[model samples]
Target: MVADTGKTLHADTLKPVNLPEPIAVDEDSAGGPRVVTLGRKLPVAVIDDVWRIDDEWWRARALSRMYYAVILVNGRRLTIFKDLVDGKWYHQTY
Candidate 1:
């Protein structure tokens, strides 16, 4: 058993992790990502995979996005998504 020390003890608060951030991306005529800009523009060397997610239609803000797993010309790999709702791009970890 622990004794009270006359000071309030608060539990650790929870916080969100890995929230998505907007990024700049250039797409091809076919609407596929051709370049991604982090600090500099990096051409996509290879597009390994692609998928889409559309959920929470009943909510005020629905989630709709097209995801891509790509390798850059500099040999770095990244997961990126295009928000179908806003037509914006973001990079995220898998």
Candidate 2:
């Protein structure tokens, strides 16, 4: 489905499921992992759910992290992730 600009219309969280190349996130959250800004901080939505993932056991140094798919009050969607190893979270704007 082509959108207004003629680009293929893809649903939010439509990225091919995969983790970023073992990168570090910013400040950790005490309230637990949660998403705030998305879409490059301009966000179409605010994350509502946080999902955790840590599979780099093979790479002992890689820290496992949490991910979130925020359902903004506007009904938009955004993805966020946090590192459990260090307790930091990063936002993935849709």
Candidate 3:
């Protein structure tokens, strides 16, 4: 038996809070997604495309580019740019 937390829920229904459906991620890490945001428990932007290239080939562990396309709840579009060297993704607002 499950206790009701003042909210009616089915046996199969899970709490929506803190449970975000990850749309996309720049890369996989033991710590989870690098950049994460939720519009309605769903990612407004997901990493649908990825471009990985070994940069500074002469140098060890060079930087790479990772691109992502995100669709916000308000129909707003955004592009996520990430630098693999430092593992950072920036949101591009249009």
Candidate 4:
């Protein structure tokens, strides 16, 4: 669900959205995802939080990702992630 603060709150029950259009990103010197483009460019104003998930490593396929809760230059907050397994970006909403 989207909060009053304009941040989308994500949950596992939320359906995964595979964007038809790829989002363009700007990275920091450290090569971390720092800016993102949806329909328009959104520079990351602040990273409210970050976390990593590494699961199913024991299996032949692994599920790994780095998630970030970020505020954009336009004052929108979103939850985005980089898939560690394939290095793709995704945005989520609930």
Candidate of highest TM-score: 1
Give the range where candidate 1 is weakest over 10 consecutive residues by summed lDDT: 8-17
Q: Cα lDDT for residue 50, model 3?
A: 50
The digit string of per-residue lDDT tens for model 3 on 1-94 reads 9987797778678654532122434344642334445433343444445555566867776757555565655555656656566765555444
Q: Write the per-residue lDDT of candidate 1 for residues 1-94, one digit (tens) a residue.
A: 8997887655665566788888899999988899999899999999999999999999999999999999999999999999999999998964
Q: Which order, best to worst by lDDT?
A: 1, 4, 2, 3
Q: What C-alpha lDDT values do all the predictions have? A: 0.93, 0.53, 0.52, 0.79
lDDT at 25 for candidate 1?
97
lDDT of 2 at 22: 36
lDDT of 2 by residue, 1-94 (tens): 6558756766873777555433232233555423244333332244466666668688868758667665645576646566667655555544
lDDT at residue 15 of model 4 (Cα atoms): 79
Off by over 4 Å in 4: 1-22
Q: Give the range where candidate 4 is weakest over 10 consecutive residues by summed lDDT.
A: 16-25
TM-score for predicted model 3 compared with the true structure: 0.40
Please identify model 1 stretches exceeding 4 Å from their true place: 1-12
Q: Whole-model lDDT for model 2 versus the true structure?
A: 0.53
> Could you give me the TM-score of model 4 versus the true structure?
0.71
For model 1, name the residue pairs that clash.
Answer: none
Give the least accurate 10-residue stretch of model 3, judged by summed lDDT.
18-27
Task: Tell me each candidate's TM-score.
Answer: 0.84, 0.44, 0.40, 0.71
